[model samples]
Target: MFGLPRNRILKKKKDFQAVYSRGKSYANRFLVLYVFRSNGFQGKVGFAAGKKLGNAVKRNRVKRLLRESYRMNQGAIKEGVSLLFVGRKAAVDAGCQDLEKAFLALAKKAGIMAGDVEFSIEKRKNCR
Candidate 1:
């Protein structure tokens, strides 16, 4: 019930390259975003966690965080866009909230968000 569907993912090397070559990039402290407007009229996303980030376990965990964050916020994005969310080394130890904040910020910067929608679910929390 909480899985990102296959159709919503970009699964080809060439597709990833298309976004890499033609898309505009935006970055924040926690993540890197690449956005390309596509004619397919669907919002497809891909994730990248380089080897330099960490071993398989850490990289995979980061990608999982990114995927869930993006999936939760995907509805706010415009149709016909391909987005790549790249994880930074810092994300290996970061919480989901931090990554989600970075994801939303980058989406806004990329100018792909449907509108000025607010993710006011909690705004912030104190776990202390």
Candidate 2:
């Protein structure tokens, strides 16, 4: 339940270019989200951290945090969209929860998430 399969991940230069060119974007202090909708079954996602963020280690760490944020809440996203998440400089020191909040807020603003969905990744046992 916590897996982001390879098929659902976007990793090609051309693919990233396509999304950037045709997508509508939403941004906040933490992230810039580029969203491109398609007529496919599963939506694809890509994460990016630029050199401005810092050294290689810092960049990769930000990317990993972004990936985990997306992975955990990916179930609430709509199908058939290409989502490119670019991390901002502020994200270098931000934690996963902060990133996740920024991501969901942007998705909500972009109308990319499933309608009226409660974004709870935790599975609570029934008290019955």
Candidate 3:
């Protein structure tokens, strides 16, 4: 591919809850973001779409796009962190690329990018 990084997929309900409860949030035209510290080795990431977004098909599409974006950009994200990508209703109608952009933008706003090196390293080390 285009030399993108791999995404560690988040799969558990409890992990999603942990992020939702403690993570700080940011919003954009199509997405809302939340991030929280993770327990080392058990750290995971997740995504969620509400019923207000649409039926199952649309909601799943939003989730898929968000997950794919997270996967491609994971290398740039801090490790041992749980991230939650929440989809706005508009996201149901938005193009996949646009939604991906929105997620990344929110990630930056939440200070989860490479520029946040010090915080990330500290967070990761603390979790260990």
User: Global lDDT for candidate 1?
Assistant: 0.83
Per-candidate local distance difference test? 0.83, 0.84, 0.69
Instruction: Give the per-residue lDDT of model 1 (tens digit) for 27-122.
Output: 987888998887862578899999999899999999988988887777788888889989998898888888988898888877888977988635
Question: Per-residue CA lDDT of candidate 2, range 16-120, in tens?
Answer: 888888889999999999999876423888899999999999999888888888887887888778899999999988877788889999999999888898674
- Candidate 1 weakest lDDT stretch, 10 residues: 119-128
- Superposed on all Cα atoms, the candidates' RMSDs to the truth, in angstroms, are 3.2, 4.9, 9.1
Model 3, residue pairs in steric clash: none
Supply candidate 3's per-residue lDDT for 50: 91
Q: Which stretches of candidate 2 lie over 4 Å from their true place?
A: 40-42, 120-128
Steric clashes per prediction: 0, 0, 0
Q: Model 3, 49-71: lDDT tens per residue?
A: 99998899989988877776666
| Best-first order by TM-score | 1, 2, 3
Ranking of models by lDDT: 2, 1, 3
Provide the lDDT at 108 for model 1. 81
TM-score of 3: 0.76
